[model samples]
Target: MVSVRRVLSILFCLLMAGLVSSLAVGYFSADGIQWIDAVRIVLLAASTGWLAWGAAYAFNGLLSLPLKREDKTFELVPTSARTAVLVPVYNEDPVKTFSHVAAMIGSLHALGVAGRFDFAILSDTRDPEVAEKEERWFQRLQLECGAHTDIFYRRREQNTGKKAGNVADFIRTSGALYEYMIVLDADSLMEGATMAEMVRRMDDDPRLGLLQTLPKIVHARSFFGRAMQFSTGYYSPIYTRGLAALQGTAGPFWGHNAIVRTRAFAQSCGLPELSGRPPFGGHILSHDYVEAALLTRNGWTVRVDPDLTGSYEEGPDNVVDFAKRDRRWCQGNLQHGRVMVAPGLKPWSRFVFVQNIMAYVASPLWALFIIASIAAPTLKGVPDYFPEPGLSAVFPRVEQGLALTLLVGVFGLLIGPKLLIVARGAISGVNETFGGTGRALLNTLTEILSTSLLAPIMLMYQCRAVLEVFFGMDGGWPATDREAGSVSLSEAWSASWWISATGLVTLGLAFQFAPEYVGWLLLVAGPQVFAPILIHVSSRSALGTAEAGLFETADDRNPSPVVLRQEAILAHWRGAEASAPAFRPVPEPAFEAADAER
Candidate 1:
């Protein structure tokens, strides 16, 4: 039985697509239905459909309140079931990574439940220098936390399956040692209270196999990074609330900041590498989503509790790094076409797979729409009005009003929800926490404007990535450069030179062949023309904090104890750099709600 919420969502998408696509038909085929017109309409429907899909989530988030926070009256005892806190690292910074792990240990110890949990540093660090550093940090982390018995460290010489494989190996060797496992990224940190609450939730539900947290982005230091951090703090909670509403029993597992029952995961999530070599085959890149589906497939409930706070992770500080991360995800998502059809999966699970694919597919779909729209004017040939003698020549009914309505409809879909969220915040005094209503509104506008500009540039990156995957170009798993500095002009141009060239050529062709859409073409292709500049400017850390704290969130204003503790550890380590050991790539690893945008 389809739930009412699901039905409403589906109907909304259908009606929105039908209304706009019909207007497109009326406007493009006023003279006669041509093949080009049909192509334009289809593309418009698909691309707009994806836009509306996001809008639907946004609207739901606006209408709904944040998920109610749970009361933690009950406490875990020393005799409670044991859980392992797993931090998987692959060729990542050792001091920074261990700092987070050490902080989590301290946090748990503060609650006096440290005995109930074990900490494991699962490393697949391939670089010997980095691995040696990782081992040194593990020793330091153990010494710092004084969890000689509970804290453990192990490194796999063969990181065959990446993060997923690393965790699987842990489970296989120590599956019987613990009842539950809290999987975390190298950058993940959570408060003691939050971990206790998550354990409580799992204890309350016998059928629950996985519990996901909405991790806030921290330590972002650039324009792009700060924007993401702000969105994660201000907008993500609402979006996550909406997701929680729709997720039901099958929710997201974002590869980290999640807890899973060890035995259940070991039984259900022995991921088989796809039969092919890379990209479409071999180890899955987006293993989290598939693991969630698999858990649900075997009757284990997978859920995300938005109200769970104190979870945190890091993000790419620059556009180029972000695009590089997306390339791998794009391949992983495209590979989901194979898993979406697996036996006995829930309908919603299948839909979720398709939805994830569209996260990247929408880029190329919109690109195709623009190209087809530009070509449509010329392909229509000549329209005939005076078929017989003395008949009045008609200027092909343009339906200018209908066209205007469609244009407004599309733009509304893009920005309308942001406006509503702002309006709602203004009414609810939520703006007070965000540095007053004025700044909230201004910041929202700035975010929308900036993301809109970046969208076109990112769309080109995704389009190329999609083409590469489809044509059998396997984007091998690459480590994330979590420590990238400001991107120089030369570097930005090197990365986006082809993007600029594509934009210029596109605009030139659109103006020359189809002058009618020159304005539209500029909006679509103009940003790409300035991709290098935008990328470089946004990559600088100084500019992000110079706007009088415009993008600052409450978290930035007063960080949680866990975040503050991590920073303290980091600072202390930096001071002891001369005394510390050094280290060194595992393929380190959203939106349109894409990976929760945070």
Candidate 2:
């Protein structure tokens, strides 16, 4: 059934692509098809197909039933497997990251399962000053959680291989100490029960190499952050369900908030540096996807349980931060060219590799299409109406009709799935989680508008990143400013001046070569011309407020116990007044007695 669904999904996208390409054929060949016109048509169809592929996923997910989850009342059996909760950090603030650690530790103890799980703060932080701070915070973490041997901190003198290397180092030295490991990022926080449930699932299936949970974004305060939070909480589940349907035994490991079999990962995921230099070579920067592929290649069952909640992570608060993060991801995906067709990988795994690469490559293709359209008139000289002196003078026809049709089709493909989800939410009363159906619809519209405005700016950024990689500029691992504040106009302009210039140049070419396209070009290039203003405004945390009720995710109103626990711990440590205990036991009422041990 899964295979059938996957095949149908592929066919649907191809059909959409072929249909749009045929329309493009008519549109471009109206004056008779030229070589450049063919290029323009192909680009338009490919980019449109990418959008269609995304819509297909959403539609498939909307129809597919969610993965079966155990009943909430199901008793958790005690497992003898020793599991290490590994939190890998790199040049991050000890205060915030350790607070999450303290919260998870307290939650584990409150569940009375601390004995089954131990934690290691795998520090790949290179700065000496940061290392000293990490040690001091580790001491405080022990005291705060009242833990000694259960919580350990290891800092490597040389931060080799970045994060993947950090975990591989742990597997080499201490993989023998545990049966499983829950790898987490610096910002990841999971509830005690979720961790236990993961362990229970792993124990039940010896072949389960990795079990990934869908981690929600928490503690977002800015407008962009809140809007993104709403999208993830609302839309991600539906989309991930579709992914879960497609990814049967060969699944994704997002590198965090996942439980992995220690021996399986240690044996299968020992990544070697690729043969070439930076960018296309060296250690894999996007190690998570590669690790998943490797695990699947080794015959270990890898899967994601989208219904498994209570897992959380922080996101970039503003646009610049998001773009910066995207650059790293683009570089990593580009690196996948080396491993896309390795000897023993599954077909779906290779498709995932292609999917990720096209995500970035699509931007440049769109740009190329636009450029070609603008230059089409001049590139093809006056059509030879009477070739060889006897042909009929077939007059050229206006091309706007099919072009407009293709445009509407592309827009529909992009926004239609989201609207369907909105409609379903309203019908099902699920929009109440997004502050009721009215607000949900309004917010969804607002998100659509914002994304439309931001699309061109992101396109330029991604195009530049891809071009840099092509020309051998490696996107090194950069420290993320996760909680970025506002950006000044000057800063915005400084980062995006080339974008403004590119937009201006495109408009000028449209006017000179394709006068009829000036209006259309304005729509695409106008946003880029004003990108600095958009970036500056979106970065302002003040734009997004809880009182607005525009982006009210369920987490905003009813935060999970783990989220509240982390916030409470953070507040206490940061000297803010706190009104709650270190760990608040929810349904596990029996463990409330263990709260005071902190």
Candidate 3:
């Protein structure tokens, strides 16, 4: 009699034990492989590496389970200790940035705890025009929000650390003045009540050096826009919660949308520039994991409060915009390779580094795996050897089953968390965030389909970004200014040909030889392969006008310079037609008056 439950349990134990053994063997075995085997070896090693990450994600999800309670309430009151709100900006629209900052300052002032909080606008802008505009904007902002906030602005003469260096500079200079610093991106906004609550959580738990809040995705409007908005709303919280749970005292740190203890950050978070050039040189692209690891090494706890709400951020408008952002992130995550082996690092920190690296490396490895699988069927001489663990009758079955199980682990990590979060939301009746269960299900299905297409597209982009970074191309944190309206077919094809070509070749090979498996590979990666051609062209018309709704949020709320400039150009044309010049520009104030005002 096959006892179904007992058999399942035993199989599960064996599967897990095999996975551990494989990973342990792979990690140690990695050193023995030569150059030609690097790709093959890395793929095999990563199978084990990725499983460990999946386990961590699963463990993180478990730890964050308590935070899912519907009735829970956070302590919202302010403590006596001071807090610093660090707003980090690159070359972003300073006017919009100041507006959001002003709103939060007003909210804090209304709460009567404004004096206890301080705000610093940490600028890394180097462009002369942009820097000048930011300086003027800061002056106006200070006059407006200064009554309730101790507002200050700092720009580095040398933008050494990019975002990380900008932040480290802040800690070195003004860190001693505050107990806690809430890090905010230029695009980020946080509610005062929630800000106070984060501070309270830190005050209550002396061991806590970091507490990250879940940020609501905002300012999306296009079809592509909606996809992003829906995905972030549906997935980020649970994923973050899972991470928080697994990390406990050793959680990962995102550079923004979180709070850090000033003293802990000052002591532990000074990022040492990696000894290399370009993508791996002068600075680590992703600094959060390194900082978190440093913090953990010093006995400070890092955590993510998924239940913490009212924090908000914006997403990229469309596929092209997303790719632009990913380019920088790819370089940043790839930089973690050097940090993983650094001296005196904590156990969890190493895990964090591996997780960061996998985000980019996995896509390429999967691409290579697909190539290998296809070639495996046709090539008579190709290696298909399976290791025999000494049980004769079950050896082949065990080997094949183990291989299948190992591969399934990748999908489990990627897809399992989404399914679990969806289930949790359904059980807890928190499905309203996705506009109810019906919408959530529909969106999830749509996302799976679209993401399949995006996978190949992203694979190529990440590959390009990684290669670019590797070959000494600098993807600095440049703010995106997405053009509204449609992109041309030529443009899309040019941008996406490599991915599309790869996809076409894969499809051709799969159809020709491996009929059984090629369809599955194409189904998962087909859309992504042609993403540049299909998505970019399809999204172009939608981009330029009201259809390309990237800046609809800013447009709806504030007048756009684009609009204003267009109107000005037209007015000048109309005046010239009427044989009269357009209204004269406002005369500059005398030097004496400008000096007096200053």
Candidate 4:
């Protein structure tokens, strides 16, 4: 028997799906649709239905917020169980990564519970220069805070399985010493109090295997990044809350900013390499979701707590960077097709895999729908609206009304949840978090316009990603270019030339065959034609102008203590070049002594 939460979630999705399919059928049938038109209708309905289902989750979240239950509070009880704060680093900037570590350590020390936790910098960086820099930064980190905290750094000679492999190595070696492990990305930062509370909650619940917090975006300065930050701050909570409501005990693990029971992870989360080459096989790229599913399969609960604040991370500064990350994620999610059928998985866990797969698959489906629409008119003559001789006679009529209804429904699905969130915020007096009502409205509009312009570009990128993955091309883990300053038009054009060509050819075809759709086609083609301008402008630091207060999030207006501390620490580290000595290896005796003490 399915649980009530699962039943309700399914019913809601089915209801939305039925309505969308009905609307699509009505619109497509009114003008006596051809075979290609039927295919377009089916694709549009499936894609739009998936989107509406998401909006429904956000809506459910808003309704459930008032009734959400609270967890047991952390009141500084004496904790016997130890936690290891695992910071995994790839070929990232060592200075910035160590700065985050220092800030988190300082925050934990301020909480007076720093003694119960140890910090581990697990380095999987293959670059020799980066590895040396990581060692030097580790020395500086220890020299600064080693007196009050336990910090350890280890670098692997070979990064066998990427991050998952690095974490598995830690588990095999030192996981026995810790009851719980808090995993963080190089860019991830969590407040000391929140970390303590998470530990306490885990200690209290033996069944809970993972506690994932909602990590808000911070330190975003570029227009694209700020817009992303604002959206994450304002909209993600509602969606997450809805997800939590539906997930019940089977929540998501985002790989970072989450706590996991060391025992549960070791028992059930040992990942196996799939039987194939890149893209669909080998080491799982998105191992977090699989781990969560495995934990649940082993009867451990995975929970996401949206109410837990102060967990934060940085985002890519521009569209190009975002696409690079998305390409990798696309391959990972698509790879879940293999894991979806793994033994002993819970039903919802399997559904979650399907949801993730659709997230990328829907993009290509939408693109195909549009392409078929553009090519349909050229393939067939105008359909006869009148009924056949044997059928009931109906007046010949175009389905403009039904088509308009479907269009409006799609628009509503895309924008209605946001408007609903705004309305709820106004009613609950939470609009101030968004910099007040007027500013919130303006920023919402700005976000909508900006995302609208970028949607087509992203759609093209995702479609390319899916096609490339299907063609067995793997997007290896590349160091993210987070600090790339303003992108020039030439650079943007070089990256998006194919987009321009596609747009030009699409617009030309629409003009030649389906002249009436030129207006609709512009929505897809115009952005691509001006991709360079949009990319360059959005990537500019000055684009985050304060005149209209666009993209002003709560974290931006009233920064949290942790955020402020992190900024200060980063500034100190970046400024003080003479305070720390160059890289020097710690003696083997010192390492042995630290391990013996543990």
Q: Please report, in order, the local distance difference test score of every candidate based on alpha carbons.
A: 0.82, 0.83, 0.65, 0.83
Ten residues in a row with the worst lDDT in model 3? 586-595
lDDT of 4: 0.83
Ranking of all predicted structures according to lDDT, beginning with the best and ending with the worst: 2, 4, 1, 3
TM-score of 3: 0.76
Off by over 4 Å in 3: 1-75, 381-413, 470-481, 484-490, 511-517, 537-598
lDDT of 3 by residue, 232-253 (tens): 6667666666555455577767
What is residue 375's positional error in candidate 1, in angstroms?
A: 1.0
Q: Which residue runs of candidate 1 sit more than 4 Å off their true CA positions?
A: 65-79, 397-400, 427-429, 474-484, 542-547, 579-598
Q: Is candidate 1 or candidate 2 better by lDDT?
A: 2
Task: List, residue by residue over 201-313, the lDDT tens digit for candidate 1.
Answer: 88888899999999999888888988898889888877776787788899899999999988779889999988877768888889999999999999999998877888899
Per-prediction TM-score to the true structure, in the order listed: 0.92, 0.92, 0.76, 0.92
Q: What lDDT tens digits, residue by residue, belong to model 4 across residues 1-598?
A: 2267557766766776677778777765555667987788778878877887788788777887564233334467778999999999999989899888877887777768888889999999988899988887788899877876899999998888899999999999999999999999999998888899899889889999999999999887788988899899988988898888888778999999999999999999999899988789899999999999999999999999888888999998888888988998999999999999998899889999999999999999988987887887777676554557777666645567776787787878888888888777777666777788788788888898899999999998899999999999755333433345567777787778888889899899899987767887898899988887898889988443843577888776666666766666666676665455543332334223322321
lDDT of 3: 0.65
